[model samples]
Target: MDSKIVQVALNGLENILRLGEQESKQNGMGINPYCALIEEAYGLDKIEFLQSHENQEIYQKAFDLIEHYFGVEDDDPSVVPQVDENQQQFVFQQQEAPMEGFQL
Candidate 1:
């Protein structure tokens, strides 16, 4: 696979992760930028993450972040959470018909 694309994206993601670590510096030197620059180095680790293949871990991380940001989680059939009136619109719309076979 092409590596240049991976390098560019990893650089972008690293730059994002560096937003909070700007204060910690050692004589004006820090690992944040160094770590961020690893995107250009000859290695597959960063590439694999920034550019995931079919079974990449980065995909999972991305999904997790999405779920967290959306305040949603996988609904387990074995367990159900108590839903209040306000959440009915989100989980089950009051105007929508409930499935006949759905159990409480």
Candidate 2:
């Protein structure tokens, strides 16, 4: 799996856990077991364990849970803003052109 994808998934899990923890604090309660397990699975040692095929399932489950909680479906191009090719070309042209009052 791509590291960027993994990082994003982990971030989602962390965000959910943090929110739950905050809510628990407000209610005068300790962190929940589900959050604790998820946090533990995201630890460095657990990440290393994910390198193995057997442990990959655990990571996948965690990612799936995070995605479900965050309401994130698979990647959708519509969700990401894209720059027009013409716009990028225009920007490049502007940068290549000499400025009126500045030396390059």
Candidate 3:
């Protein structure tokens, strides 16, 4: 219901997909099966497939696995970085111009 909850769920899903990609690579597979499934659904504009009732069950199970394996918590406040006002402000300086006739 809450956006934060959705974000956490999405993060969990991403973690599962990342692991799938790594496993696929280790097995000499060209494409990750998990990512391929998402791509196929996305081609039909079916992004909601992840949120569908059936998939939600799978996602919840995968999320639980991710939490158990990675020690990730959806409600961990320390997960978010706290930036102070000074840290939020960044200043960039321009580099000096290169020589006009320089050749590579």
> How far off is residue 69 in model 3, in Å?
21
Question: What TM-score do all the candidates reach, one by one?
Answer: 0.23, 0.36, 0.38
Which scores higher on TM-score, 1 or 2? Answer: 2
Scored by CA lDDT, what does every candidate get? 0.47, 0.56, 0.56
lDDT of 2 by residue, 15-97 (tens): 76668867877888754444556556665445445445244555675555444443335687545555568767322223366
Per-residue alpha-carbon lDDT of model 3 for 1-104, expressed as tens digits?
55456557667667867788789779998566776565566621323433343445545654544444334336755454555577795444446997697888
Backbone steric clashes in candidate 3, count? 0
What lDDT would candidate 3 get against the real structure?
0.56
| Model 2, position 13: C-alpha lDDT score | 58
Q: List candidate 1 segments past 4 Å from native.
A: 23-104
Q: How close is candidate 1 to the true structure, as a TM-score?
A: 0.23
Model 1: colliding residue pairs: none
Instruction: Give stretches of model 3 more than 4 Å off.
Output: 43-104
| Clash-forming residue pairs, model 3 | none
